[model samples]
Target: MPQPRSTRIAVIGDIHNHWNAQDHLALKSLNADLALFVGDFGNEAVEVVRQISTLDLPIATTFGNHDAWYTATPWGRKRCPYDRDKEDWVKQQMALLDHADTGYRHQDFDTVSVVGGRPFSWGGPEWRFTDFYGEWFGVHNFEESAQRIQEAANAAAHDTLIFLGHNGPTGLGKEPEDTCGKDWRPIGGDYGDPDLAAAIAAVKASGKSVPLVAFGHMHHSLRHTKEVQRTRLCIENGTVYLNAACVPRIMDTEIGTQRNFSVVTLQENQVTEVNLVWVDEGLAIASTECLYTTMKVTEHSASV
Candidate 1:
C-alpha cells in the first residue's frame, strides 16, 4: 500500500482564553486530518482544554508562554522551573494528543509525519534574557533547546517533516512587524529567538524536506491598521512559516474579524496551499494562496 501523500491540517493559533463557542465550532467543522495547535491557551487553560476535547481528531501541540503558567508547578515566586510540574496538567488533560516541549516528537500518519516541539527559547508566563543565557528557574536553556530540535529532526524517519515552534525562529525579518519583528523606532532589532533561528537553519540545511514551519507568540498587528493581513504568513527559503498568533495585545476587539486560524495543505512533501481563516466573526477565509514553489534567499528570506 502506498502512503498518504496529502494531508490537511487545521492550525489553531493563540486562544488565550478568548476563544468562544463560534471558534470551537469552526474548528470542529474543518474536518481536517490533523489538528495542530500553536499553544497559548492562556488563563482559561482548563476551559480551553474542555473546548478542544470535542474536536475528536488526532491532535498535536506545543506549549506557549501563557500555557506554561497554567501547566507549571507552584515552586518559585514566578513559577520558573527549578521546582515545577511544567505543563504536566495540560499533558494529563490532553492525554490523547502528542505534546512536545524541550524536545521534539513526531506523529506518523503513514506517508507524512508532523514533528513538533515547544522551542525552549522565550516561554513561560514571564521570559527574561537570563532564561536563555543560563537557565531561568532551572528549565529554559537556549543551547540545550536548540540542540534537541536538531537531534529530533535528525532522528526522524519520515521524508516529509513539518516543524512547529511556539515563538518562531529569528532571522525572518528585523522589522517590528516580522515574525519576531520588534519596533526599532526608538530601539531597533528583531525580537525573535536566535537559538530557535539557528536550530531552524540547521534542520533545513541538513537536507531535510521540511516544507512547513508553523508558530505563534508574536502577533499580527497590535494597533488597528490596514496591515491586519500582513504577518499571518511568511514563505522563505523553500519553507512556509505561519504566524498563528491571532490575538493581539488588545484582546476581545479583533477576535471574530481577524485571521486567527489556518488550514494548511501539504502535498507530496511540499506545501501546496495555505488558507488563513477567520472565526471570531463568521468563519471565512481571509486569505488563500498557492505556495508549492520555493524561493531562495540569503540567510533571511521574504515573509509574506
Candidate 2:
C-alpha cells in the first residue's frame, strides 16, 4: 500500500480579530488537507484555533505583527523592545494566548511552528521592523527566518509546504505601485529589509521549490503584482509566491483600498489556480486566474 497523497493546502492571510468571519468562511468554503495562516490572527488567535480545531486538517501558523502573544512574556513582561498598550486589548490578547497554550498542551489544538524549527521557532516578535508603525510591523530577523525556511524545505518531502512571515520574499509577488501617483509610501516599504530579500533569493537558488509562500503585512491590495523582483528569481529556480492580504476597501477607497484574500490551489507539485476573493458590501467578490501551468509558471503575471 502507498501513502495517501497530501490534500490541497488552503492559505489564508491577515485575519485581524475577524475570527467569526474566518470561521464562517472556513466552514463554508475552506477545503484543504492543511490550513496555513500567514499571520495576524489578532486577539482572537485562540478563538481562531478553537474554530480550526473543529476541522480534521492540520493547522499551521506564524506570527504577524499583531499576534500580541509574542509581545508579552509568560510573566507579563515586555519581551520585545517595542511598547504596546496592554489595557483592554492587551489583556484580551494575553488571555487568548494563554488559552491557546493550554489547548496545545492538552492536545486540543494543532501545533504552532515558528521559523527556527524550535518548540517556538526563531526570531522574537520584536525582531520584525514593520511592527513599529501602529500595526504589527517589525518582527523576526529575515536572514535567520530565511535560513529556517530553507532548512524546512530541505528536510521535508516533495509535498511539504511553508507558511512565510508577514513580510514575504522580496520580489516573490507583485509590488504595490503608487497607483494614484501620490507620494504616500506605506510603512512596510520604508522598513522592508533587504537582507530578507537576499535570503529568499538564496532559498530559491537551492533548487527546492517551496511550492507556496503566503504572506500579509500589506493590507491594501488583494491582487498579485508582477513587481516582485524575487518572483523572477523563484520562477528561474521554481517556486510560487502568493500575497494573501484580504483588505476589502481597496476598490472603493481612493488612497489605498481593496479587500480580498488569495485562495491558492496546488496539486501535483504545481500551483493550479489563484483566486483573489474580495469582500464588498457584505458580499464576496472574486477574480480567478491560472498562475502556473503543467510545464512552467506564467510570465504575464498580473499586478495589484
Candidate 3:
C-alpha cells in the first residue's frame, strides 16, 4: 500500500473582521491538519477563536496590532464604549476573545512540536506601532520581537521547521509600496527592519535545513510569492513566508480580491508541495521557483 500522506497545515493571514462567505469557503475546502493564523483576527478574540474552532482543527495564532485592542480588564472594558446594539451583536457572534489572554499564556507563542513526523515552531508579537490601540496590544519594539524569534529558534530541535512572525522577515519579499506608499505618498525607504534580516540570515547560515517562514503584516504585498536567499519565502519550505491579510480590497465594500490562504504538506523532512487557494478560483498550485532542496557549506583553512 502507498504511504499515507503527511500532515497538512493551513495558514491564514490577517482576517480583519471581514470573515464571511469567502472565508468559510477557504476553511471548509482546505481541510488542514492545523490552521495557523498570522494574527489580526480583530478586537474580538473570542469570536475569532469561535469561528475558527468550528473547523475542528488545532489552531496556532499570534497577535496583530488590531487584536491587541482588548487588553483591558473587565471593569476597563466599559471605557471603550460601543453602540449598545452593535455591542450586543458582537457579544453574540463569539466569546473566545474574552479568554484570549489566558489562552495565550497556556497555548500559543514561541514554541515547538512535531507534526506528522516534521518539527514545527513559530514566534511573533510583531512590532507594535502605537498605543492608540492598547498597551498590551503592541510589541514595544522590533528588537523584542526578534529576540522572541531567537528564543523560539533556540528551543527548536535540530531538523525542525520554524515560522518566524506575523510580519515578514525584514527585507525579503517586502514591497516598498506596501510599507511606504500605502496612501499614495512617499513615507520613506522599505518598511522592513535590517535586524530582522540579519536574524533570518543567521538561520540560513546555521547549516540546518529550514523549509518555511510564513508571515503576514503588510496587506498589499500578498499577491505573488517570492524566494529569498537559500529559503523559499512562500509555503513550499514549510519555512516559506506569506502575508495572509484578509482586509477588504476597498474601504466600505464587502467584496474584495485575493481573499486567499495556503496549505502546506510535508513528508520525511522535505516539503512535498504547497497549494494557494484563492477564495473564488479554487486552488492554484504554487511553483517552487527559488526553493532550496539542499544546502552547501564550505570549510577553508585559515591562511597565515
lDDT for each candidate structure: 0.60, 0.43, 0.45
The lowest-lDDT stretch of 10 consecutive residues in candidate 1 is: 291-300
Q: List the RMSD of every prediction in angstroms.
A: 5.9, 8.8, 9.6
Candidate that scores best on lDDT: 1
Model 3 residue 1 lDDT?
88
- Model 3 per-residue lDDT tens digits across residues 1-304: 8985566766776777767555666566667766666666666455655676565456655555445443333433565455554554234332443332111122232223321100111112233333421243233554543454444454555545545345554444323333211212342234444435555556556665566555556664323333311122333223544444434421221443445566666655455655544544342222222222233111110001
TM-score of each: 0.73, 0.56, 0.57
Candidate 2 per-residue C-alpha lDDT over 239-271 given as tens digits, one digit per residue, 9 for 90 to 100: 555555554313554433334445566655555
Worst 10 residues of 3 by lDDT: 114-123
* Model 1, position 269: C-alpha lDDT score: 75
Clashes of 1: 7
lDDT of 2 at 178: 20
Candidate 1 Cα lDDT to native: 0.60
lDDT score, candidate 2, position 295? 53
